[model samples]
Target: MASIVKRMKLGSQGLDVSAQGLGCMGMSAFYGPPKSEEDMITLIHHAINIGITFLDTSDFYGPHTNEILLGKALKGGMREKVQLATKFGIKRVDGKIEVRGDPAYVRACCEASLKRLDVECIDLYYQHRIDTSVPIEVTMGELKKLVEEGKIKYIGLSEASSATIRRAHAVHPITAIQMEWSLWSRDIEEDIVPTCRELGIGIVPYSPLGRGFFSLGPKVVETYYEHDYRKDLPRFQPENLEHNKYIFERVSEMAARKGCTTSQLALAWVHHQGGDVCPIPGTSKINNLNQNIAALSVKLTPDEMAELESFASAENVKGERSWNKVYSWENSDTPLLSSWKTVE
Candidate 1:
């Protein structure tokens, strides 16, 4: 019941959160079927007990289940102890996935999340995916109003391009930009990472453990349940999996030399990125959470960082960071505000 994690500023704009966050997506959906609500609540409480309080979730995660679960978990004064974050803009309609970022949808989603989360204000709210058709300014305009109204504390964007980030930040200061940045996922480094650093926005790296690949290694693919969504990702396919296993092997060898587990080393690499960067690594079990938290202690020298990078350099890693091309940062730019017209 003692604090094990440190608190750090996520962005220059006065938003502070735990050094690392607990990603709550897997507890309700994506990785597999829904876990027992009772057990997940216990896991959530345990995370807070150990100081991993920057909890992240999205409305589309279960299409709603995840937020409701967090609402329940944060009851009995638990909500007062954490910096809760949830996202919107990704939805499913008639079995198809869609992303929305218009002012109307933004306001509606914020209201709905406030209700679901049972909180007066959200610590941070993000557009889960960019809506290419809507102008970033328009979406952020509404979010700015929310900030004025005290509906949300700060704005954030996930999987957004450098241009979109600038436009969104011009409308309202972006506290964080959540993206997939891990040993195997380094495409953001070319532009997005630098843009955020220049603009003083924090980087929240989701899937910091390579979606569980670094933790369990290649054979872990065999343990995927029938409904596990990871099975659909190309990197885990038999062909790509064969090629990717070596990256894990090399990382494992380095981890052994570093006196830590492969998962810890992989996460530590992200932690070493800088104090402005925070990685939200998700797990369904307490032991895994402990291992991830321990990653904060696995320091690496510059050579070790570069050597780890060599193992899973983008070219060496197979498959796209996203299964759907549209969901990635490359395709996340929105129309200019000057070119946007509202449909009545």
Candidate 2:
């Protein structure tokens, strides 16, 4: 055997995963257009063949359509090829987004996910977001119960603050922390990264390409479907798009100098964060998926990493990632001390 399974342990619970994981969100809807069922199936099979096994998904995406698509992909022998990870907690109910960490919701969500994924047990189950009103202990306590019952192999959290992470860790060992991290989105590096490294929690980054802003094409930007959320994102605005184009052109130039695609340069830079960091870039097209996975081979030297950092710091990239009133993506708008209360 030529050493196939890419293993990077997430935490104290001994939960190891592939060096690169496949994020299945785009196949359901969020990217731009709805991808065909056949493309999703072929993409899953191709991922297995390339030795990329860690798969990340959530129940809220497509309001359950993505899990159904993944279930279809896992049929027969292909199910054995992945170390599965899925989340529940943040949900959209009656057109209103809510975070439900209630124990009742947890059990119901797991059952629904099981039915959709067609899997007996999920390898890694995460609390997509903490319902601050519910208390971290209460939520993790319920998740702990699931672990004992064999519904999940390990526990993880997403977009949680450092204090929340500490409180949750005290309740039970957190295997990994999934958040948005890239050269463009380095906010997590300040506190979250240090906390995860100190606690041995693996960091899985989503949106490693700055929402395709690196080769960052104009044609690609205009192709967004009506339902696509990126159209509202600050980065995609006409004014910011023009300003950001220069930054991406620089990124493309750097990629050409290093002999790789702009996407590859972005992903490779994310991988450089540390050995414990793994990025799951989602794409519905097989060509994009292939280009993304090939990023693993594009390693940057120490000097190159420094150059990348300096290049990014110098850019006057316009617009925050989110609309001003709503708040920035992968970052907090409310102050750290303020408490979160549920609408219900």
Candidate 3:
């Protein structure tokens, strides 16, 4: 039986998707060794069978591998059943990750993603990162062209500042803005959330479980493999992970009182943020997928929401979300449009 999940509207352009989305990054890369393609396909099929219809992937996730995986998974009659979301703009060159938002690059990336996904039009296409080098309007203009040509259904921005979002929205209606918003990552609430609410843009939180910190606890970080992306993140560092244990412990206690798993509690908090907000929690295991989907039913009381909010406030978090200096571009509170040089 497919679980009956509520639908949420993303962006003002009539983009409606399942309230909780499935982030497909881990099935291809990032968390650890890539899961077997057959396993991931089965998992995605199960997700759809259970009513999780919003599937998120990125052309850069596997540097073109993730979309390929999704393409294979959505074969037959599966593609039409879900709202597919994929991102572009981040690419690896000379073994270094680079951001590109040039209008030409935008069109090329979209065409390539369509080829990889084996789909005529992407349901929602997001700029993986704000390319400060190109004026946001230029990138948005290219995306607008894609929409007009029926290459993409709607446009979105990821890790963009409130100012950049406003500028991009002026060019076209941004259906959704993806950000790191979880119980522990509340920085977006300071300005980005308010701006999106005012602009009628939908919010899609990428790491709503704090990169598995909220659900798996600090111990999971200790065992991360050298190749695992989280091994390089500051929050998962030895000292910071120890300090962050307090947060997991507190959340576990609260979950115990609520008679739900810690992950369910964590996801429920994000779900309560607003109807316009959707959280995409990724997992390679089917058990974890079922657990995450169950979160939709773990409704938190107003008092519980307040208490958890106080406990998981940004100040309570002990480490930076990313240790890479390049990631600062995504974390900036203010847009640095003038500081960026165009890619030649």
Per-candidate TM equals: 0.98, 0.91, 0.95
TM-score of 3: 0.95
Winning candidate number (lDDT): 1
Q: Which of 2 and 3 is ahead in lDDT?
A: 3
Which sequence of candidate numbers ranks them by TM-score, best first? 1, 3, 2
RMSD of each candidate relative to the true structure: 1.1, 3.2, 2.3
lDDT tens digits, residue span 78-152, model 1 = 998999999999999898999998889999999999999999999999999999988888899999999999999
Better of 1 and 2 by TM-score: 1
Cα-lDDT of candidate 2: 0.79
Better of 1 and 3 by TM-score: 1
lDDT of 3 by residue, 1-344 (tens): 75677787787889889889999998888877778999999999999988899999999887789999999999999999899999998888998888888889999999999999999999999998877567888788899999999999999998888888888899899999999888888878888999999999999998899888887897786657668888878888888888888889999999999898998999999999999999999999899998998999898889999999888777777888877645443443333345544333
lDDT of each: 0.93, 0.79, 0.88
Clashes of each: 0, 0, 1
State the TM-score for model 2: 0.91
Alpha carbon lDDT at 225, candidate 1: 80
